[model samples]
Target: MLPDEPRSSADPSPEGGPPGCFRHPGTATGISCTRCERPICPECMVPAAVGFQCPECVSRGHAGSRRATTRFGGGLAGDGGLVTRVLVGVNVVVWLLAAYVLTPQLGQTWSLFSAGRDVLGGPAGIADGPDQWYRLLTATFLHVEWWHIGLNMVVLLWLGPPLEEALGRLRFLALYLVAALGGSTFAFLVAGNLMNSVGASGAIFGLIGATIVLQLHNRGPLAPVMAFLVFNLVVTFSRPGVDWRAHLGGLVLGTLTAAGLMYAPREHRGPVQALVVAGALAVEAALLLIGMSLYGA
Candidate 1:
């Protein structure tokens, strides 16, 4: 009989001897797997709804069962917020390094300086050369002022956990990075080459955009999130030193990323979400290249 087919009758014992467990051949036993009908020792038995099953049968059953996932196809493991805490910690450590450990000139190296700008009497910033491309990502984590990092981290702590739980750690991290790069790319393209910018505000704005998208996806109340977004946008435009381009770019990219993630077809969610992120990154890279050419960097 097939392994999973119901047995008509229990198998006879080995010639002149009791049956031994299929797994532990040395152990004699009268019990059999309810599903497979193979002789089983107590150690190899697993409790089932009707009767004990052998380990192999239980494993097969579990293998066929669907795994639990978040509403947006994310694994439930991200609910713990490990990624969020790590991001916050990294931002804080970078800020501390810039604020105290590094000299003023050295710290300026981490900021996203304007294209073709002469810093410390030398060419610096991303658009200055292809080798300095790291600044696009590094600038997001660099901060010299206490209030700048403090406000960003606070918003991150507030928005990160739920979004992480919804999108999963890997997706959430990807969105943050793509948003940060998008912000940097926009700032580079729009702001004068002489204008320098640094802060996690771009990535934080991405989180806000994600939260708003998630709220809409779940049909939840929007007032609270909308109010928060509005206030921040006001600050972005009104504040003299703020890089509104970065904020706007991050927000727009983040929103599109979150929408693609949350609205993807169930059968193709992973691939679709991946395509969305990759597309965003590609667009930003193209824009950066165009900006470089325009600035003669």
Candidate 2:
């Protein structure tokens, strides 16, 4: 047999092992660090009033100990908040679902667009029922392919955190809803039929537009902001599958809405914000109604 290993007082038994210590080499000593679950040495251990903790646990606890107790506002500056996470999740899920179900490239006759179009009206714009108006809201969530959703989600990931933190969740979500409806309204107007266009770009672009106002309101640098806006605008026109009109409409609506929300007077801010958002939406709706009036002519 091999020579027995040397033992010290730190080692509990003659075998030089504690009860919970690892059987193999390079294993935990006795208890794991409560925070990171790492095996810590006695020298590295930090004594608590009740038990011992590792250095990492001591450091983490010490760091958090002096921090303010408030919960809502912290951590958003580092990365993003819950709203940003939710938007990212929603876009990703919808995109993946569309890819599996639709199979757009193979001409498989399966598409969320076509399904939404059929639901809203026949391919020829023939309305089947009065309740079809709701598709305008529902269709905004659908998209055709990976690039489509990817582009929008990338922008959302980039733009959402600052905006969500700046405006709070309710306002950020409201702006998104308005911008999305604003885009669909424009598509309905331009196509004059039940043509379905889907993607989060409109709302993503809205977030971008709102960021512009936010930067302006805060008197921050503008060159980087302008560069981002211009690049995306170019992409909107340069790509074939992209919806430039809806993008443009959403940008304009979002800019106006954000301007109203941020720059408008404090006392009248609510009413002004409402009017600007509602008016932008109404303008697009009127255009669609006017076109529909002429559709049968």
Candidate 3:
């Protein structure tokens, strides 16, 4: 029998010999892999888009599972989106109302300060609600001057949509809020009592950290983002009043959180993600407790 001889379709075997599984020659099977056309028993057959294929043909390495994507992670974002747009809109509207209508008054409220006289820039000893608690998140929204808010908003506009798309509405929102919390919380504890902090640099830097973590999972281009992040870090530290500590806190927390998110097996994804988030928050809470012990706040 010639090796290249064409077997009839109705013959039920590759070479019309006794019908049996290719993998298990002793076991007979009528089914065959669609691509390789090797005989596959019911056990070896895996259902594919068109038909069953032998496990060997169907099995793709890590690269084969995902759809082809653009240079950036392409889970979504090309489509005009709601979450990112809405978030940006809120920031813009808030900035407009605060910057124009409310003016200096709004700026005073949305800055990081503890329960004491602010010796540096901010009004001394704001009311308890705005001073201790609200500042953490509100600080994310407020900026000192026009250039400050302008830069942060531009970055958010560019970065947020793609991220929101990749992470889904719930996960993305959770990440942003926590990033802001972690950043502000770090400032509250570590920064000197006199210093006041504002702006979304921490959250934006968190996005940078998330992007880095995601690259590990997806295996995308590294050079561009790395250079960009490094440049930003240098500028953040070198510039006056940058709150490098807030950026560090947000960056670290976001990276760890994203790492937990990407590392989880798809089957047990949610619970694993929750564990990571809870663990991160636990660490923050511990730090808060220590700060309270020392500082008596």
Greater-TM-score candidate between 1 and 3:
1
User: Would you give me the overall lDDT of model 2?
Assistant: 0.63
- Write candidate 1's Cα lDDT for 214-249 as tens digits: 998899999999999999999889989899998998
Model 2 pairs in collision: none
Off by over 4 Å in 1: 1-18, 47-51, 78-80, 117-123
Backbone clashes in model 3, listed as residue pairs: none
> Which residue ranges in model 3 land beyond 4 Å of their true spot?
1-80, 115-131
Which candidate ranks first by lDDT, i.e. highest? 1
lDDT tens per residue, model 3, 1-297 = 578987443345655665678888767777878898887878898988787998778665334877643232224445535676776777777788777888788877677655433333332432233335666788888766778778887877777776676776667766777777778777656853545778888888888888887777689887776887899999988999789988988888877777776676666776877787788778766655454443432
Candidate 2 lDDT score at position 297: 26
Name the weakest run of 10 consecutive residues (lDDT summed) in model 2: 106-115
- Comparison by TM-score, 1 against 2, better one: 1
How do the candidates rank by lDDT, highest first? 1, 3, 2
Tell me the tens digit of each residue's lDDT in model 2 across 1-297.
246856433345546565333223344377655666555666666777766677766777788775431122222243336677887887676666667854554222212132223233443321222244455555556666677777777778788877777665656677787787677656655654434466767777777888889888889988887899999889888988677766876787787877777775655755775676678777767755654454422
Model 1, TM vs. native: 0.86
TM-score for every candidate vs. truth? 0.86, 0.62, 0.67
